[model samples]
Target: MVAEEKTEGQAAPELAAETAGRRMVVLEDFKPVAFLDDDDRASAVRRYSTLFVVDGRTRKGGLGRVLYAENAWGDRLAVKVLTAEEGADLTEEEQQALASRREAAFRREYESSRLLTGIAGFPTLFGQGRIDGQPALIMEWVEGQTLEEARRRLSVDDDGRLSPLVAAAIGRDLFDLLSRMELVDGGLVHRDISPSNVMIRTQRASVEEQAAQGKFDLVLVDFGSTVLPARASSLTVRYGAPQGATPDYAAPEMLTADVARVADMRKSPAVDVYAAASVVYLLLCGRPPFQLGGSSTGGEGAEVASDYLRKTTELPLPVRAAHGESADVTVALDREGEAVAAVRKALADERLSPSNQDLKEALVCVDKRVGEVVLAALEPDQRHRPSAAEMREGLAGFVEAYPANVVAALQGEPLFQDWSFDERRKAGGFEARRRAGARLARWAAVVVALGLGCAAAALCSGVRVTAVGSLPCSLEWGFPLVAALALAPAAAGYLVRWRGGRKRSGLVRGSVALAVVAVAVEAFVLSATVDPAAMKGLLGAAPLACSSAAWCGMVLEYSMSAPSAWATAKRPAQGVSGKGGSV
Candidate 1:
C-alpha cells in the first residue's frame, strides 16, 4: 500500500572484476582444495596470507567465497568475500575505475571488520591479506540460525509476528550497542542488519516453567555489506526514515517508501530502532508487524501483509477467532485515530520521536525478564541509549538478579571500539601533514633566502643595478621574492586541504593564514633593508614564524585529545625539536 513494494530499491552493487592478463598483481600462491573434506580436486585457490576461492555462489546463494587466514597466533576466521566479478563483464575504463574501487572497498572492509571486533555481539577478525593477490580479511565464523529461520519455526504465516516484549529486548540491546559505538568508534555502520543478521538459538522452556528462563546469544554478522564511511546518514543506508534497518523490519519511514527520491539518504541511530522495533514485533507475535511481501528469504506478500509498521494496527483477530498461532496488536499508533492514509504516512514518514514511552509501552506486553534499566535505554532519542558498557552491566545485573529465569544475550562486547578512534586518528594525521608541510614550506623559504644571499654575493654583484630614481628602492629586488617564498607554504597547505574536516576549524584556518601573511611581510621588509646587520638579526627570527606555525599544528594535535598537558608539552616539541631541526 505504501508503493514501491520491493524492499531493496536499487539493484545490488556490481562485483569488482578485471581481466587475467591486465591484473598486474598476479595470483602467486595458487593452490587447490575442497570445502568440507578429506578428498577433493585441485580447485585453484588464491593464496597470500590466506586462501581465496572466488567460486562466487554461497551457501545462502550470495556472490562470494570464503577467505581463510591465520593471524599471528594462527587463529582461523572466515572472511566473506564481495567479488569484483560483477564488474568482470564491463569495459576497459570501467575495469580500471573498478580496480581503484575494489582497493577502497577492501580497505574499508578490512578497517571496518577490524573496528567492529571492538563492539559487543559481533564477530571477531582473525586476519586479512591479499590472497592470490586479491585483498581479503579473515574473521570468526558465526554458526547459528538466522532470525528468519526462527521466525518460520514460530510464525503462523510467513508474515512473522513477534511479541512486543521480545521486540523491546532486541531494541534495548541494539540501542545500548549504538550508544557505546558513539562513544567508542564512528567509522563503521552495520548497514545490512536484517532478520538474517540476527542469529537465534532456542532452548526448551517447559509448561511448569512457562515464564521460567530464556537464555540466548545474538550475533550480528556480515560486515561485507556494511557502509564503512567516516560518517553517514544513520537514516538512509542503515535506516530509512521509518525503516532504518530493512524494509520488512523498517520503521514507518521505510514503510512510506517515499525516501527514494531524496538523493542523500540520512537518518539517525533511532533509524535502527524502527527495524529493532520490527524485530521486537516479530519476537512477540512470531511474525513482523507489516507484511509488505514476506520474510526477506523470499516469502509471498499477502501472507506477510500483517507485518504492520511499528505502533501501527490492522484488524486484531477477535478472541473468538483466536487459534494457537493467532495474536493481536492494540498498537494503535495515533492518538488522533487518524485515517488510513495518515496512519500509513506516519508509519512511513520520518518520525520525530520525543520520548521512549511509546516504544517502552509496546515492549511491556512481551516478557517480564526484560529489565526496566535496559528498557530505560529504549528512549527514542539516541543520546539516551545506554552505553554498551552500561548495557553490558545492566544485562549482567539482570542475570545476577534473575539468574534462574534469565539468560545472557550476547557473550561479550566488541573491543573494536571505546571512543572515536578513527576521528582521533584522522585528526592527528591531518595535523601532522599540515605541520610537516608548513615546516617544509618554512624550510623552503630559508633555502630560497640563503640561496638569494649566496646568489647576490656571487652573481648579483656583477649584474649592474641601474640606480633608479630612488636609490633606496634599488636595494630591494630580493624583498619581493622573499614574500612570494614565505606565503606559498600556508597557501599550499590550504590548497592541499581541499575541504577541512571536523578537525580543521575556521579559527585554525584563519590563524594559519595570518601566520603566513605575517611571516611573508616581515621577511620582505627584512630582506630589502639598507642595514645588513638588521637583516641578519631579523632573518634569524624568521625561523620563529615557522616555529609558530609548527606550534599551532602541535596545539591542534593535542587539542583533539582535549589534553590538559598539551600546552606544556607542545612548546618544547614543535618550537624546539623541529623549529630549526629542518631549517
Candidate 2:
C-alpha cells in the first residue's frame, strides 16, 4: 500500500517497536516521502530491507558522525545524524544549547537541500527522518574524488600546484555554481566552500557530450553549514550561531566575534566568493594564502587555525620602523634588520608580493589576462574581489579569446594537435598578431620591389631624357636583354613561393598587365614622335623588368615572413598533453 502524505502540521513518523532504540533504522515498509521522486521512493521501498555501515565514525566540524552505508540493493549513501550523545556529559544548560545549535544547523541543511533540488552539481536529497530521536539526513552518493585529491594528482611541480589554465577553469566552474545557487534562493549562503567539499568527477563522454548534457565535471558537496539569511536570524538568536567553517578557507568577516551581529556576515554572497577564491589560490599555489609559520598537519591544528585567523584579520608588520632624520643613531642595525627591510619592501611591492610572484612564476606558460583575473579575485578585502558572475565572465573571456586547440592543449587533452590549422587561430591572441604582421610586411616588400623595377627599367631603356617631350636613343636589342635579366629573377621567385595558390597567380597576372599597359602608353607616345624600333625595345624590356621585380618582391616577402608562419603552424603539434595528464 502507498503511504499517505504528511501535512505540514503533522509530526514525522515514529520508529517501529523493534527499531525504537537503534541509531540506524531499516523501515519494515518504506513510505513515499514528498521530497523524494517516484523512482527513488520505489527504490527505497524495495531496498529498505537493510542498511550496513561501511565506514565507522566519520566526523566533521565536531557536530555529527557521517556514516557511509549501502542499502540492500547495493546503492551507496551518506547518512548524517546529529545525536544528543555529543552533549551527554555536559551540564543541563550547556547540553541544551548544544542540542539547539545542532538541531538548527540540521534543519537549515535539510531545507536548503530541498530548495536546491534538481540543481546541477548539487547532491540529490532522498528524505529526512528521525533515527533514535536524532535528526537524520540521507543524501545521494556522489561518486568522485574530492577536489583536494584531484589537485594532488594534477599538481605540475615539486610544490604541488595546478597550472594557471586549469586553476582558472576550476574557478570559473565553481563561481558559476555559486551564481546559480544565489539566483535560485537569494538568501542562500554556502558557509563552507573548501577543497574537501568539492568533488571532481570524470565523465566517460567527450567534452561536447558533457556540454550537451548540461553537466559539469565539478560538483559542490557537503552543505551541512549552509545558512539562509531570512531564517538564520531567528535560528542564531534562539540556538546561538553555528561555527563550522574551515579556518583556512573562512572569510575574515566570518572569523570575527561580531559575525552574528554583522548584517553582511549572515547573507552575503561575498562569503562564498572569498572561500571560492581561496580554493583557487590553494590550487594554483598548493597552499592557502596565509600559511602558518609551522606545519599545517599534526597536533598543531589549533595553532595553525589561530595563526590563519590572525593573519586574515591583521596586516603583517614590516621588518623595521621608518627612519627619523633627527633621531640619534649610535647603534647600527644588524644584517637581519636589512634582510627584514628587503622582505618588507618586496611584500609591499605589487610585482614582488608573494602571491603575485607565485602566480607570475607558475603561470609563465598561461595568458597574462588569466593571472590578473585570479589575483583580483584573491584580494583580501571582499569589496575588492570580483562578484561570482564577474569572475566567471573573466575566465570565460579568456577561453573565448584563445583558440579551441590552445585551450585543449592547456587542459591536457590528447587529440589537441589533430585539429586543423584554421582551428588554431585566436582572434586576439599571439598567433593572430603574428599573422597580421606577416601579411603587412609581405605587402610592403612587394610594393618596394615593384617601384624599384619600374625605375630601373625606365633608366635602362633610355625612353626619355626630357621631362616633357619624348627623346629616344638609337633602337637597341641590348636594353630588352638588360630588362629581362633584372625582371626574370623577381618573376621566378614569386612563381616558386606562391605556386598552387590563386592569390599568388592573381598578383602575378595583375603585375604583368600593369607592365603591358605602361609599355603600350610609352609606345603610343614614342611611335608618334620617335623611332618605332626603339619604342618596341623599350616596351618589351620595361614589361620584362617590372615582371621580374614583382617576382623578386615575392621572394623577399616569403623570406621575411615564412619563418613566423611555420613556427605558429608547428606549435599545435607540440600539444600540452605531456605537461599534465588528460583532462
Candidate 3:
C-alpha cells in the first residue's frame, strides 16, 4: 500500500510537467494568420480562430477599407486592405500602375511605421500580409479623435478662431514628433501631416477629473507619403502627380511649376515644416492658409487647384481678419479671391523687408515669435525656409516661455489647468504676496509682544544708568530705541505689502537697509542723550538692539516667504507624482 501511494505521488508530478510542456508548445506555435487570396479566407479564419473581425468595414473611402478586429486576448488592431474592385474601371496598364503605387505606398507606410516604433508620438506597425490578393497592413489600433475632429469640436471664439494657446500647444507637440522622426536615419520627412493625420488622446472625463488625470498626448499617423532619404528622388520623379499632399496644406515649392523637377525641393525638410505651419494656421483660424473654394471635380476642381497653386506660388500667405473687423472688410476678400489685396501686399512687402513689428501685424492671435517662425517656414523660396529642427526649437521655446496657466486656460485642458494652478501658486503673484503679508503681520505682533516683555523685565530688574559720554540717560532713554528696533520689521513688512511690485528677495534687502539705518540713528541718539559715565553701556546696547532688529527682520521675511520656497522645492516632486499617477 505504501509503495502504491508513493507511485501515485510521482505520477502526479509527471502529469503536471507534461501539462506545462504542452502549454509551452501551444504558445510557441501561435502565429497570426494571413489571408493571401480570396479563396483562402476560410482557411485564414480557421487558422486565426482567436482573432475575430469586430467590424469588417469600419471606414471605406477612395483608398480602401479599414477593418477593425480584435484577437481572443481582446487586443484590438486596424487592418488597411486595398481591394482590387476599387479601381476596376481603369485600363489594364492603368490598373497595373495603380496596383504598383498602392503596394509601394502600403509597404512604405509599414516600413516607416516600423522604423518609428517605440516612439511616444508615432503609431506602431504590427505586421503586413496580403488580403484577398490585395496588400494589407496591420497596425496597433490608436484610440483617439483626429486633430481635425478635435478642432471641429472646439468652442470657437467670436472671430471663428481657436485659442492661440491651443494652437501653439498643438504646433509644439506636432513639431516635437516631427523632430523625433527627423532624428532617425539623418532625417525622415512626413510628406503629409495635416489635421486629419494628427490624433489627440485625452481622457473623457469631467474637467476636474481630466485635470487630475492629466492625459493630453498627441500622436502622428498615416505615414503612407513619408519621404525617407532613399525615397527623396521619388518625390521629384512624381512631379505633376498629386505627391500625396492636400492642396490646402501643400508648400509653395510643391505647387510651383518651376520646382516641379527640382531635386533640392524634394530633399529639404522644409516641405514638412511648411505643412506644419499650415496646420498651425488652420488651428489658429478656422480656415487653411489657402482655402479651396470649389469641389475637387472636373473643370471647377482644376480651376480651384490651379488657383490655389497660383496663390501659393505668387501671393503672400494670407492671415484671417482680426476678430472684430467690419462685415464689409471681412467680406472684401473672396474665399478664393485676392480679396485682402492690400493686406496681402503689405505682408508680401513685409516678407521682403521682414521686421518684428510687421510679423506681429501679419498674424494676430498667435505669438509674434511663433508667427515669425511659421512665416519663415512658409517663405516662397524653399532655400529660405527654416529646417524642421529649427522650427521645432522655435515652437518649443514659445511654449516654454508662455505662462503655463494662460496656456492651460486657453487650451481648456484639465490636467494642464491643475498644473497651471500649482505653477501660479509657486510663482507667488499679488495673491501670494498678500498671504505672505498676513503671515508677516502675525510675526510682527509676536515680535512686539516679546519686545514689551523685555521692557517689563528691564523695569522689574531696576536697571538704571546715570551718565554716558557728554550726555545723561535713563532706562526710558533706551526704551524708544528698543521699541523702534522691534517695530522695524513691521514697517518693512507693511512697505512690502503696500508697494506690490517687490519680490521676496527685494523685501529682504529692504529689511536689511532699514536695519542699517536704524543702527546709525540709534548711535546718534545715544551720543546726543547719554553722558560719558553711561556711554559704554548705552553704546553697547545700541549695537545689540540694531543687530537684534536686523535678525528679527530677516526672520520675519523668511517666515512670510517660506511657503513659496517650500512649494517651489516640492513642485518638481509633486509634478513627477502627478504624471506617474495620471493616465
Candidate 4:
C-alpha cells in the first residue's frame, strides 16, 4: 500500500539487461515510475515523466541496489531498488519465495524511512514506487563520501589509525545521534552501523569558510536494516531471518540467534554503543580489539563463535559445524544460548584476543581519559556501559579540550594535524622515547664524572716536595691510582641510584662491579711494585674525590629516572613516581 498498484496492459517497463555474475538492476534512462502521495492509499499518484539515471552512480548491496537519478525538473535524488537475482541453481519456486522475502524487506525500509521523517542527520524521504515491477524508494540525494573513505584517508600516516582527538570528535557525533534516536517513540536501533553506512559531508558553505572552520557533518544512512523495538520479535527472533549486520561490527549478542537474549536486547541502546565504540577503537588502535578465532577457515561469525569458546572452554566447535547446517530447533537454540553467554562473559572479563590491557596501554599513550571512556563504552555487560548521554558527556570533554581551529584544519585532506607515535614522542607523551633520552643523558654524565675524578686524582698525587724555590711534580703514581679513582665515582653513583628506590638493571650493576674490581686489582699490583710513600698523596685528594662522588651520585639518580618521573608528575598520588631526590 506504500506504492502505487500495478495495472494490467501497462507496457513492460524498460530495464537494463542483467550482466553475468553481477546482481544489479540497472534501469534504462527516461523510464517512467509512479510514486503515491504520502497518504498510505492516496488515489492521486505522481508519475515521474522523465527519470534519468546518473551514470557511474550505481551501488550494489546485499539487500538491494542504490543509484542516483534526476527527474524532469532536474531535482536530484537517490533511488533504492529491491532487486537481486537468486542463484541459478535454485528452482523457480525457491526463486519466487526469495523474491517475496526481498519485497517485504523493501517495504519495511520504506516504513522505517517514514517513521524517521524528521530526525536530524537522517535522509529525507521523497517518494516510493515500483520500477519495472520491482520496488523502489526515492529520497534526497546526500552528496558526500562514505566514512570508510575518510577513515582510509586519515590512516595514510599512522598505521591505519586516526588521531585520538579526531576519533573522539567523530564518536561524540555518533553518540549524540544515537541519543536522539533513543528519544524517538518506541525507540529505534540501527542494527547495522558499519563505516560504509555513515557519510561525512562538508557543510554547504564557501571553500574559504570551509577552510576556516574545518567543520564536517556526520550522516547516518542506510535505514533498510534499522528496527523498532516493538517490531523486532517479528524479524530477528523469527527463525531463518538472518541477522542484518556486518559480522565484524556486530555485538556478541547479535552473533548468535538466541531468541530470548536477542529479543531482550532489541530495546537496549548498549547494542549500538558496542558498535560505535568498536568503530572508535578501530580509529585509535589501527585494528579491532578482538581477533576472530576461525576467521581464516570460517567467516567472521564463526570466528567470533570460536573466539568465544576458545576463551571460555578448552574445546571449541569445528569451523565447519559453526559455519551452518540444518539442525533441530531445540539443539540449535541450546547451542545459540551457550555461544551467546560465552561471548558475553568472555568480553565482560576482557578476555578477548588483543587484550583490553594492551589496548589501554596503546590508548594511554595518546590520552588516558579518552581511553577510559572508549573502553567503558566497549564494556561487554550492557549494565556496565554508560547511557548514551553519559558517553556523549565523556567524549565531549576531550573533544572540547581540542582547539576548534585545529580540528577544522585537521579534517582537511592530508590531515594537517596528526598524532602519530613519533609526534607524540616529540610532545613528551611517549614513555619509551623519554626513557631512551634519559638513558643517554645518564651515561654521558657518568662518563664525564669519571674523567673529571681521574684528572683531579692525578693532579693531587702528582705534586711532590723539591729543593727550596723550585716547584716539583711527579706523574709516576697517576696511572694506577687515577684509574682506581675514576672507577670509585661510577660505583658510588650506581649505589646512590639503587638506594633511591630505583630498580637497577643487571647491566648497570655488573658494569660498575667489574670496573671497580679490575681497577682495584691493577692499583694494588702497581702499589706493591712502587713506593709506599706515594699513597700519602691520596689524603690531599680527599676533598676533590668527595665532591666528584657527590656530583656523580646526583646526576645518575635523577637522569636515570627523569623520563617516567616527569611524565607522571601530574598523575594521582598512588601512581608511580620518581624516588630519586633532586639535587
Best by lDDT: 2
Candidate 2 per-residue lDDT over residues 1-583, each given as its tens digit: 1233333223434323223222334433333335467677665555543455544434342246666656647777766777553433467887777678668877877888777877887877766655455677777666666778776665554455554445666778988988888876665788788998887666464332332233348778766678777563432321233265665676666544444455556467787887887787776666776655543212244554465467566542211111111122111112113212322332333222234333233223333455455555544566555678766766654443323323332334433232122222232246445546656655665665556555655565554323224544443424554455345545554555454222545455545654555555455434433333355454445445555556454544444434344223322223122223321
TM-score for candidate 4, please give it.
0.52
Q: What is the C-alpha lDDT of each candidate?
A: 0.39, 0.53, 0.52, 0.53
What would the TM-scores of all predictions be? 0.39, 0.51, 0.51, 0.52
lDDT-wise, the better of 1 and 4 is 4
Backbone clashes, each candidate: 57, 4, 14, 0
lDDT: worst 10-residue window of model 2: 318-327
Alpha-carbon RMSD of each model: 19.3, 21.5, 22.2, 27.7
The residue-by-residue lDDT of candidate 3 on 343-388, one tens digit each, is: 3343343233334333333333334445555666676666556566
Off by over 4 Å in 4: 1-12, 15-49, 88-95, 156-158, 203-215, 232-241, 293-304, 307-366, 402-583
Lowest summed lDDT across 10 adjacent residues in model 3 is found at 7-16
Q: By the TM-score metric, which is better: model 1 or model 4?
A: 4
Kindly report which residue pairs in candidate 2 clash with one another. 487-548, 490-551, 490-552, 491-551
